[model samples]
Target: MKLIFALITGLVFGTGIAISGMMDPAKVLNFFDLAGTWDPSLAFVMGGALVITFFGYRLAWKRDAPLFGGCFQVPTGTDIDMKLVGGSALFGIGWGIAGFCPGAAIPALGTGRWEVALFLVAVVAGFYVRRLLSPAGSAKAAR
Candidate 1:
């Protein structure tokens, strides 16, 4: 049941990404080009998402638990530190360069594009590298 829900959720998310033109690297790249060929569509999409998420969280908080899970897995971390800042900067750099964050990239993999595949491979490699570099306990916490 949980797996079925997950698959359905992923399909819905991918469909939304595709329909919103988020799967197109060129479109995504244009969104970052503030000085030239700037596209504001991504901002609209993000705004829509933020609205939905704000309401969704409000409703979810009223419930005792999720429908398919015993409890929510919300992150408890609230401190701002070097590790957080560095990771966020790295993510932004990757997104600016590749024009594909993990969410959109996963669906883009179906397009049979080598660039998309390569990006995903590098993301996996990054995960492994980070784990290798972290202390044993920190690595587990990273997850």
Candidate 2:
């Protein structure tokens, strides 16, 4: 049931990404081009997602547990540390250079683009690199 729900949710999210032109690297790059031909479409897409998430969180918290989960699994970490800052910087740099974040890239793969495939390969490699460099305890915690 949980897997089913997750698949359905992912499909909906991917569809939204596709419809919003997020799968297009040029469109995404245009959104980031502040001093040039900046496209505001991504902002609208983000606003819509934010609105949905705001209401969804409110409703989800009202339930004792998720519909198919034992309990709500929310992030407990709230502190800002060097690792967090570094990872965020890396993510932003990668997105700016490639014009595709992880979520957007995953759906873009369906287009059968070689660039997307390379980006995903790099993403997976980054994950392994992070795991290898993390502290022993932190690596175990991730698992």
Candidate 3:
């Protein structure tokens, strides 16, 4: 049941991504272009998401646990550490270069684009490299 629910959720998310035109690298890239072919549609999509997430979190907080989990599993970290900053910068750089964040890229894989495949491969490689470089007793190792 949990797996089924997850599959349904993923499909809904992917469909939303496609409907919002987020799967198109050109559309996403245009969102970053301030002086050139700037597209404001991505801003609208993000705003819509923020509104939905705000209400969703409020409703979720009223419940003691999630429907398919024992706990909410929210992140407890609050520090503005170097690792956090660096990771965010790297993510932004990658997004600017490829116009595909990991979430959107996953669904874009169905388009049979070699760029999407390469992006996913790079993402996986990054994860492996990070795991390898992280200290044995660091918070990253706990993952």
TM-scores vs. true structure, each candidate? 0.91, 0.90, 0.90
Candidate 3 on 42-114: residue-level lDDT in tens? 9998998899999989998999889987888777888998888988898799899889998899998888889
lDDT of 2 by residue, 31-129 (tens): 999999899899999999999999989999999988876888777888898877987898888888989888998998888989999999998888888
Q: Is candidate 1 or candidate 2 better by TM-score?
A: 1
Alpha-carbon error at 33 in model 1, in Å?
Answer: 0.6
Q: Write the per-residue lDDT of candidate 1 for residues 63-133, one digit (tens) a residue.
A: 99899768988888899998789989998998898888888999988789899899999999888878787
Off by over 4 Å in 1: 137-143
lDDT (0-100) at residue 17 of candidate 2?
A: 97
| Candidate 2: worst-modelled 10 consecutive residues by lDDT | 134-143
Q: Worst ten-residue run, lDDT, model 1?
A: 134-143
Off by over 4 Å in 3: 137-143
Candidate 2 runs further than 4 Å off = 135-143
